[model samples]
Target: MNDINREFVSHDEALARAEAGVAKLAATRNDRWYPKFHIASNGGWINDPNGLCYYRGRWHVYYQLHPYSTQWGSCHWGHVSSDDMITWKREPIAFAPSLEADRDGVFSGSAVTGDDGRLWVFYTGHRWANGVDDADDNLEVQCAAVSDDGVHFEKLGVIIDNPKGFRHFRDPKVWKQDGMWYMVFGMSTADARGEVLLYSSENMRIWHFEQVLFRHPNPGVYMLECPDFFPVTDKDGNEKWVIGFSAMGSKPSGFMNRNANNAGYMIGTWEPGGQFTPETEFRLWDCGHNFYAPQSFNTVAGDTDDNTDGRQIMYGWYSPFVQPIPLDDEGWCGQLTLPREVFLGEDGDIHTVPAAEMAGLREDSTDLGVVEVKSGTETVVAENAEAMEIEMTIDLKNTTADRAGIKVHATPDGSYTYVAYDDQIGGIVLDRQANAFGDRGYRVAPLTADELAADQLTLRIYVDRGSVEVYVNDGHQTMSSYSYAADGPRAVKLVAESGDLTVASLTLHNLKSIGLE
Candidate 1:
């Protein structure tokens, strides 16, 4: 095949070239910072979880990929499948820039099992005008593709053209409700207001525009990308609708929305042909440095093991955009956060916990039961701390310490990443400043005075080769980030800043790597 990097290539040729590129890179690549238990690209670059669905007795996750290099370029769809969401098997490059509509890129989209026993994918087809790759000089249209075997797909051409009064339009998320198909697209008004446009389709091909479902109240939110609308049952068994989107150029407040882009959701109500009425304000999904463009998956009817429990699972891209990732030099970049089971809480907030399937990854367990520290840090686990799961509970009602929590991925030198509860901030903080190769900053998940007075702060943390995911207080709050630490003895430490602190219980489990290498 001719070089696919040339100005033009056929669809088949693009897929062949991508396979050859992955083969070439796998022969001579060795990277230490790659994730052990996350869904990452085999080579090149990946971002934005797309086309998430359960089909043919397995879970499928498609993502935005650029297989030619470790930097962003013309996008393709990378594929992976798993019986459980934890152990993944890489598939072939699913979609390339094949047709005129998507000649430049096959952007982000969603998937569903059609009524005819086929998997249907709806996505944005992006093309550059006159070979200029500027934002204002491009074409974006909604398109669809179908797969009979759940592997290979055939394009069905453009489904929705670019509408007027919108400068930026992309990331189509489709679903079925009330025996009819509905789709939501993230768009920006000509005057720079972020909006989500709703549409209805009868056959999942022809779509008619409905009203704007939800609009950003703030003028600073320039664009909303990858909008997902779905319903989740609260603790009281009442179904509530949720609308999630990634906001670009969003105004920063406190430690939230401090990145170049952030993912958030709103709880609201919506009908088939009416606008969304939000009952709560916008809330951030994960307060971390490297999270964006999260998508959710609920099993459709006639699928094997139909998810009748109303469980909604989500995965977010665990890396930020336009930043210098340390792993980019190793011929691959990016990972997806662990699959999280999301639900509505009694307090009317969206709550996410690591899915129950993650427990299958635990191996040798070490119980460091009930360790206490006074006015300083103490070593909890002296070694074998690089990849493990930690479960701990701190007695907040009985402790008088100003700050106390656990630190992981630490070296003998004064370098470590920590998750601590600070009395001054009245929140839990995840700090990665001391040992990070890039992207250094901390995130705070605020807590109320009533919560602190209730007596305990429970934490479940997962530390991988170059990343960490922290779930606090039974998923009341979560923080995830990438931290490339210096080489030394991997140790775990517990800290108490000013006074005595008591730990009710603590246990550490050495986790098994999925062996992506």
Candidate 2:
């Protein structure tokens, strides 16, 4: 591979070789993936994880590269390769938005290994043919790039041409079945409805539109983005199709108090020639707010298991709609949700439980069972630990605090979240303590004030060396973030402004990354 963006220069010598355009992002401070050697500088904007496929004895990942600017300008395909999907090696620029068909930028898509062993990437080609560079010309088309070796790709011209109908369709996910290939692209239709365009390809080349796999039932409102279909098997020893997509829309109330972006899954059977038996219904892929744009690679590639769910894992961009910080200084913006193990759980829902690989990063462990705190009381820090989760249940009967609950990563003096049951305000308040970025992140996402008025708080919070996630009441409510190092900790602090409370129980755990050395 050659340095395609030679004109672009970076401050760091090691990062300079990356062919990346932006400076190192101090976006994350702690263990948020600043390897002494590896090259993802820091912060800016990173979207769609493109060209995700299990190839060359490793999982090769290509993404829309905005390594230079943060606002989605002139994207090149950034490269990263990983054998175990944990530690990633940054590769050189694979492809950019140079072709006339993709002047606006090369959009999100998938990579598939052709029957001939060559890797063929099917992606959305964004262009403005009218010679106008305005935002209105962002038309969508399908294009391909083939790689004899998984690292480098060559433009293969347009494959599936854009036809008339919907204006909002894009992001094609391609895969093979019995020597032939198929693609599912998301789009908006003439009827103002969202649909997934299904297309077929022979010899991994010339294409044909098969049929409309799915539509957003509702018109004009629900535009689908990032449609992916993978094969899974049920306990009855039957093969099923898991077609999933993100419903791009505004935030709703309740759990919908989220910023923006959400994903869902449908697990039914696909008969290629016949119709797809849609799963009983669609369910949220991740109830959490940050997860979006999930792509999978068949870990057990080519296995003939009747129960086909291998490590069909997923990775998503954790998007916080109202960012606490700006992107101008930090050249990068987002981080991927720790890879998750995806499969149909007992309840017939696509269970996206965290990957077991994360357990390996555990450094130390502790537990506090049934802590008791009088009004205005807090615990002193115990022995230090790293990469952990603190699980606890509280009974705040007759409590008077306008605030109360466990304080995560609580420093000696600051940086904590006061999860409180406020009788005065009548809601749950996530009072975040002041930190390096200041205390701007504190905001209240209302909870069920009626159901839980009984004075009970059960919280399960995970504090990784670099990231933090709070899963309230067994995943019903969750908050996630990449906390800086100086600010990351495994300490526990409990407080209530008005009265005494009993900590029903507490358990601390050491966490780690799986399949990683």
Candidate 3:
């Protein structure tokens, strides 16, 4: 069910192959966080973040690649790696469905490094035999594979295929703590309530089923995709290990199902012997239009010398609904948001920020001192500003404008990265039309209801060599985009059409990471 990409395939053949890869369904148009090597196309489906672990001096990311059609098929775990999280190198197929139970496709899974320093993958076994199926039993059961070198993996065969009750349970996150291996997976009951289950093992195999960590109330009945459990400690002495789940329910959006296959978090204290707060009440990590399938790296970030003294950093596939922009003409679709450091806030709430290492990616910085924009005003960035950082405010109360926004990371071809508050359009729009990241074309993410009515909007737009992230009103809403405009005349612009809004302050600084400091 797999074929090698001929090194010397003709242009037409390569185009066809690329298009064939395009046929594979893609979902969760990831925020503009991915580096250049990662690419995806129009909607179909995308499951877990694959090959997600630090191995042998580098970080690896494998995704359920359905390169033939956007519709979920024989999912081959596509591979890519990076040393600094900046420059990435795409490798060959990491894992293809080579078993009967998982024949329909490799499905989605997480990558883990065992105590032996070998990378072990704990994924679901779906499809009957022929890599395709449509039955209750054909869906999911856990299976695993091992890899010494991140690229080549040896399927250890069925590790544990759907043990005991519950018709559907999949997407396992494995980790070793206190001398025992543990796996947390998303599950569903016969009544359709979504649940997160726990399993433990002395070694990598022979596991005992634990209790359901948490489950959905009702509307989110179908199934939860990826489940992660880890500790989140902030600057103070507060420590809370969080258990999270994501639902991909067939239910529509409403009080019942705000996000189809949505992602949420729950804070709890870990009990003895691989058990957790089983009666935990789940809450949201963020109330945004997109955010789902969040996974954590096993590597303890910050001063790796003491793994015990690190924070649980997270990376989620921000799943945005397809609207306001078309994906076909763009050629590529979704991109992941930058890795983030997740921790507990002093208020006992969760807090997240772009990974500290990403700050090193800043290039040039600029500051425009207190440029005021009434209700309806537009402005362009000055020259010599390729990469930039901006702090601007729009006065929504002063004027009756339908929309107002600031644009940066612009190209001479008229394509630019924009972060605007559009009352007429509703929501904050991170428009990257002409400069579609990875040729995926323009993407517009509307702000949540509360976001649109913030009264005033504060925007921070960061432009790297090929990526841009827009954070509004102190992380109220964030839309990240990935694109390569190394040659484009990068600048910033502001547009406040239909309103007499005034700007509080507009400061741009050259990227500190690019020696412009």
Candidate 4:
């Protein structure tokens, strides 16, 4: 017998193992750095938000999960459901590495409602040739699981075998458009060039290869993972399509692509089973250090309610791959970025804003009206900085500072993460080198001339226990990263580096916990 056969377990046994592991960790896990509102794993590790869809009046989100340890291992699908997208309830583990096709692991994929009124999930079944998890030499194929109630899934085995001449193939994002089912798979040619392969099916089971939807122009990018394609309407009522994926082996350029891996998207035009023609160059989805593998909710799938309202809502893995996560020793690591509504901008680009339902989390509100800071001074905006939501507008027309913005997770010992607009670089900078845990570096989000011409810069920031997500100018740009302070009594401060600046308006809101504990 082969090594995989020797190690394989029945579906029931696999699920029991996962549940026992989670139960053991729950009894003694630490909550020091657990997020107050974000979707984090109960224990162990999670990455790559998968199988996002609006089904039966609830938002269903599945993720790549490894429940036995706080590290990456053989994968299972972790499940959660929400009625309003703000408060979530954990569901049973969805998929596990049980069958021969998935003896090694279950990777990332998407979900769609089948014609038979069942929720169908399509994912990659991975097996390493050397019989070791995460080994470089492996085989991957597309697989499916179906559920009538969205809680229990029945494995359908392999759906699409590995295609020839592809060294890497995985991450199937499936959707329906114009009465046909279409799927996109991230693949790398045997020659090591990254491309997105398109396929179509009248029914969800049988798929036929169409053509290459899009390819990375840069040969340096060896592979693209977690590809998502969706349509959005712009402010002028012009419809456009967007292609997004996470790029591995992407070289760093200035302040972009600095993370170990980067996620980006291109605005383009694509028809059902047709070629995708790009209208804009590739752009980073979030100019931050820890955002990747974003998946959008399929609003048209299943029996979705009017709450979605045809919005392209998305969630990303809020942790960087191949980086140190400080909370691993505490028995859990990784989180999901807040749900963002993506739309096509008038400038022919994609922009994301926090979902409207997020306002429901606000509790006590304080309006710190019209605060000004001198050239060499700083003003404390809020003393209770932990678990807060802050919105502020800086009057750039009347500002003369070289650098002006807010400092979050600030400690009295001169340690804080700074988010500011730098006049010298003409970009927004997120600096976390001052006594923060994990990776420490700065990232810049460059502004276009049109953006700089505007007289004000609006910022909406969410500060959790160990992370901060900043939305700039209503999500024309965003930065999401983990920043943990070593000392307590952290405060939020507004500072001017070289010259005076005026704050036209500022408000702080104490957000309520989602009761994840």
Q: Output the number of the TM-score-best candidate.
A: 4
Per-residue lDDT of candidate 3, residues 289-402 (tens digit):
445677876465211433223545566664545343233223333445566666665545565666666656555545555565555556675653555666677665564667
Candidate 3: worst 10 consecutive residues by lDDT?
1-10
Tell me the tens digit of each residue's lDDT in model 4 across 433-468.
Answer: 894577788888888898888899899999998888
Query: Model 4 Cα displacement at 37 (Å)?
Result: 0.8
Error of 3 at 267 (Å): 2.3
- What C-alpha lDDT, on a 0 to 100 scale, does residue 485 get in candidate 1? 69
Q: What CA RMSD would candidate 4 show? A: 2.1
Q: Which order, best to worst by lDDT?
A: 4, 1, 2, 3
Identify the superior model by TM-score, candidate 1 or candidate 2: 1
- Write candidate 2's Cα lDDT for 1-517 as tens digits: 1122121222133234335354343333333333221123243456667777677676677776666655555556666777655566656667666556565567888887777678888887776545466445356678788887787677775666667623565888887777677888898766556677788877667788899888765453356788988887666666778888887663455544244666667778887866666856655555443557777766555333332336776666655344554433344555566556666544444555555655544456566777777788786534343455676777757455556676555555565444555555544455544444422344343445542665677666665443455555544444555443344444656776667767777777765443211
Please tell me which predicted candidate would have the highest lDDT against the true structure.
4
Q: In candidate 3, how many Å is residue 410 off?
A: 8.6
Candidate 3 regions with alpha-carbon error over 4 angstroms? 1-47, 128-137, 164-167, 234-236, 250-258, 273-283, 286-290, 301-309, 318-325, 328-331, 382-404, 407-458, 462-469, 472-492, 495-517
Clashes of 4: 0
lDDT of 1 by residue, 1-517 (tens): 0222233557788899887876666565555767788888888788999999888877889999988887888899999988776677888899998787788899999999998989999999887866667655667788889997667998777888887724578999988878889899998888898999999988897799888888899998978999999988777787789999999888788877877888999998877777788998888898878888999977653375744345688999986553567776777888899889888877668889998889988988988788888787575664747678899898887777888888888877777888888888888889987874777778898876666777888889998878889888878788888877667767888888887778889999888776565
Report, for all candidates in order, the number of backbone clashes. Answer: 0, 24, 42, 0
